[model samples]
Target: MPFAGFYAAAPFAWRVSHLASDFAMAWFKGWSQKDQRRSRTVLLSGVAGLAFIGVTMKRVPPGHVGLIEDWRGQLLPGMYDDSGTHWVLPIVQHPVSVRVYPVKKKLVKEFTTKDGKPVEVMLQMKMAPKIYYVPEIYLRFGRDYGRSFLEQEGAIDVNSVVSQHTFDELVGDNADTEDIVDEIVSRIEDAAFFHKIKLRDPNIVFRDPNADDDEGP
Candidate 1:
């Protein structure tokens, strides 16, 4: 979750307001009652403005990008807010933060090898959505785009690739499983690219499904 800018700015606003109030009291001490009340009202209005600004602005943290969406669930085009504080309408517009940093996800699939042995294969991948395509990504997959699209498509590709190789070819000393992993990664990368996700450094490990608790990916 992204932190709202108001929380960090509120304290500063509070201190400024306090200083202004103290100064106002000192300055209005010798003034007429009517004039003092009017001046105090102005001070209070300034404080209220500060509070409103604090509440309306949101912070987009490092390694993340922000999108603006309207109250009617429609994304505003070309409204990308980068890493910084941005002002957005409280009710009419909403700011959405999407992580651009790579996140690690592990996919485990069970399938039969070409030699008919049941095996479990685990694929580990690091991926992140492209910052520029965040709006489109959010529209298609919501916030959980990785799990919704990448993982689903990756699992299908992994199953398809792993089932083509025999158990010996998968686990043999001279086996070129790197090529297999590369193939699966390529396919997944291509699929994820269409959804604006960048897949990186994917690895796969195969293990016997009937074995007793072999647990390292």
Candidate 2:
């Protein structure tokens, strides 16, 4: 098979063909026996290089950012790659992808109202890391930022707002549901902002705890 054909069989064959062509001329060169052996060595080394690139090269899909980290778990700052192909060093470095698009998260918590009533609250929100702060976000919160920061911190704010309202102000026919949801979202947005996450249109649903009670109303 042609040398290009050999490269064509590699995992990222289509992508690596241009790379293989750069060194392939060595195989067709006129040389003495010793020089031919040297050429073979160089050609083999080129193949190895191509393989290394195939293994280390990473492609960050659309709407995502990629970061590089070493085996020691250290991230290289200011070197994040936007959507496209990039090379991560072999063996010593690997790729970490963080989605830049909004991610929807649902949080359920039981909170005690000012009237001491237990209300099951379901909060749903869409959030995404600020593009410029993605590296810092990963550094501080790691890849699971949604769970580590958003959910944990957001829950606190949610409960705080819920605890301030009486059961009638939160869930009954007299409930000011819109105002309460707005307050919860406002508090969560503040928390999310400090953590470098952008929150959008957070919503809440309340289920009456007494609805499931065996006793008749």
Candidate 3:
């Protein structure tokens, strides 16, 4: 078999299935000693390049919200790959999973009433990469946003959005707290801009904000 064929075959074996892992140690060694080391070097170099590219740089999508990282599953936020190549080499597979924890949030808070009363306001923030943007979310945020949850200082910002309106709007019986939260979500949707997130109309209460059911309706 040609040397190319050998390299090709080396990546796939019936027993192990992933021959690339088997040859992972001396992956660069060529089939024939007579072959010029230069070609080996070049092929190895190409392999290295493709290996890195194969591991990274998902070629899936855009407008997503997630975390990104190098091979180690480290976190890299607000990052993107410049380019990617489609190599004829089978040493690596296409559609390799780009490590990505899809972006999502559930808002939970204790709202202080005008009388300085604390009311627990639990919100469910449903934000995910709009299908088309899942891969982009991974590329942008890395595997774990790159490390667990992001710093959602948006509370302050969300408060700002809340502050713009009246107390009645937020905690009003007629208005409903969930509707108020939905409004807050809309503000976030616009503020985030390129961030792909979905905000459902917030419901009135997570688990009955009423102090107790004993109170008459």
Candidate 4:
């Protein structure tokens, strides 16, 4: 009968079904491996691109100078100017900023005049580090040169110069205060020159010696 042949064909149909299922699984496994390789390649390329950008880019602000230091902690020879972007070696070198604009420093101190009279003086001066000597300045005073060197040494010079002058010379209308100011400025200038500082206009205000308060009215 035709119904008896159906059972005979069942074994052959089962073999064909099993073969198709095995082939499908093999194709899926190969496709997954290819996708994994592609993903790994993309990840590595992105990391390399970011690392390249980090090493080659630098920015210096306006009215400033950039100093480059190598991995050995030695400053580079050339001075970088202000307000521009620059390129430097990543991880091998770094940049430091030094202000090129004038920096104002003030000193208020009490000193004895030539006549043995005690006087109070308030002095203000503007100065900046020389562009060429900035690296040396950094090496010596770091980034705080204004407080570390300028204010400290400038006060000492001012006190020294004021001690040599009479009280009347500073406050008397007939006396030439400009000469006294010039002398003080010159001495500070000489001291600062070695430290890479350049001096600008200096202003002085004298307080009444008899006043009890430090900031005399």
lDDT of 3 at 30: 54
**Which stretches of candidate 3 lie above 4 Å from their native place?**
1-68, 71-105, 113-115, 130-154, 163-169, 175-182, 198-217
List, residue by residue over 1-217, the lDDT tens digit for candidate 4.
7777889899998999899778756645756787857865886799788888866777777888888889998988877786567778878898888887898877777788888888788878787888878888888877767666745787787778778878888767736788887787788778888787887787877766676665556
Prediction-by-prediction clash tally? 0, 0, 9, 0
In angstroms, give how far residue 209 of model 1 lies from its true place.
3.6
Each model's lDDT: 0.81, 0.81, 0.48, 0.79
lDDT of 1 at 138: 86
Candidate 4 C-alpha error for residue 56, in Å: 6.4
Measured by C-alpha RMSD in angstroms, how accurate is candidate 1?
A: 5.9
Better of 3 and 4 by TM-score: 4
* Model 4: lDDT to the true structure: 0.79
| lDDT ranking from best candidate downward | 1, 2, 4, 3
Question: Model 1 clash pairs?
Answer: none
Question: Which of candidates 1 and 2 is the stronger one according to lDDT?
Answer: 1
> Per TM-score, what order, best first?
2, 1, 4, 3
What is the C-alpha lDDT profile of model 2 across 1-217, one tens digit per residue?
Answer: 5687667677587567866776565555666779878877987999898898799778886778888989999988755456468878878888999988998878877889899999989888788999898888888888877767756887788788888888887887754788888887888888888878998767788888767685776
Per-model TM against the reference:
0.71, 0.73, 0.38, 0.64
Lowest-sum lDDT 10-residue window in model 3: 85-94
Model 1 agreement with the true structure over 1-217: per-residue lDDT tens digits: 1667878888999999999879877899889999988987998899899999999988886777888889999987764456468778998998888778998878776878888888788888788988888889889888777776655788788778878889877766645977887898788888997888988787888877767766556
Candidate achieving higher TM-score, 2 or 4: 2
Q: Model 3: per-residue lDDT, tens digit, 1-217? A: 5588777776465547555556643654554655546556787899798787666545534432333434554443343332443222233333333323344455566555545445555544444445445565555654433222222533544555554545555555654666666666666557444555344443324233555765887
